[model samples]
Target chain A: MLHIVNKSPAERNALESCLRVAQGGAILLIEDGVYAATRGNAAENHLRDALSRFKVYALAPDLEARGMGDRVMEGVATVDYGGFVDLVAEHKNCQSWL
Target chain B: MSEGTIKKFMFVNRKAPYGTIYALESLEVVLITAAFDQDVSLVFLDDGVFQLKKGQQTKGIENKNFSPTYRALDGYDIEKLYVEAESLAARGLTEDDLLVDVTVMSRAELGKLMDEMDVVLSF
Candidate 1:
């Protein structure tokens, strides 16, 4: 399963909830969810724990838009729109933890 | 709606009340869905648990205190209210702080329940 989270962890618990319920799935952070992929955020430790279970990715454009491209935490991959489509195709199903 | 056609509907509420319109709009939709006689359940997580908090006074904000409507959900037969335990603890709230009776479950339990739903609407 591909779990897509778009809400910022600082503002909402969407990312937190997705992490808790999702077991060994891909997590693609987009929109404000990119905040979690950045360094020194409150959710950084939680995201680190998720790295052990899931392959996490963040949208390149969203990170750039927020000027956080250079601050992305280690182990989190960045993908473009085409890569995003490929991820959707690769996963059996997708859930947007809105 | 036909008896055989009723689907399991779960409404996920994650926003705080008064700060935004999502809570009120979601409540209206929940009430309307109840009219159709579907198997409806409401999940209050994150800041959404605040929606069920008791003794909400909105007179200063000039907003109608809709927290009372949650207690009236039983009359509508929409009593499957679930609150996330972690969310309550993070917000310094307990089951006793809420206006209505609700099953407090862990995130894992709620996630399993979500998987069983035929349809889920998030707010």
Candidate 2:
């Protein structure tokens, strides 16, 4: 599994690159990525299809801070600090998108 | 052994996109390395989170806001995303305000994750 941490638009391309290699993977949203949760956002739609049945997660803390926790799209789970470590253990590799 | 090893690669985005080329240029490298079949992931922290915001107008700045490009990323197969929890709290940003889905790890945890990676690239 692989993890992507995109906080910028330029970094999104990197996330796109990772989708090509994703076999068993997970996508986590934190920091600025929380903005993707907005209604009709294009990035959110793209991420949904890119993961393709793979696990997708986001940070609740970030969501709440930005006042978007309740607005996050469904299907993607939210992970906490401990869950973050679990992701590291679960995935063979991790990369930063930004 | 080194040549065949499929080490996990991670990207840490520390700055907002647009003003500096580091984030955008670093993104290009991410795609290039993925084409090489490297396992990759991404993290957003500090001002880096600003890259994913919505409704940004770059007209006045004479630059194109790159946030919309994030939607096209799925076409390239790059979707694994992450963020730094403390950073978000410090910045007063929430998942709802972000542009994508990702995991929020603590600073210590994020650092530890990097230690476990075969490759760690930050922009």
lDDT of 1 at A4: 86
Can you tell me the DockQ of model 1?
0.28
Give the Cα lDDT of each candidate: 0.90, 0.68
Q: Could you give candidate 2's per-residue lDDT for residues A1-98 as a string of tens digits?
A: 44565463334554443443334457676687656644456677766675464677887788788878777776778878788788878876665554
Worst 10 residues of 1 chain B by lDDT: B111-120
**RMSD of model 2, in Å?**
14.9
Report the alpha-carbon TM-score of model 2 versus the true structure: 0.52
Give the alpha carbon lDDT tens digit for every residue of B32-87 in model 1. Answer: 99999899999998889999999999999999999999999999999999999999
**Best DockQ goes to which candidate?**
1
- TM-score for the second chain in candidate 2? 0.85
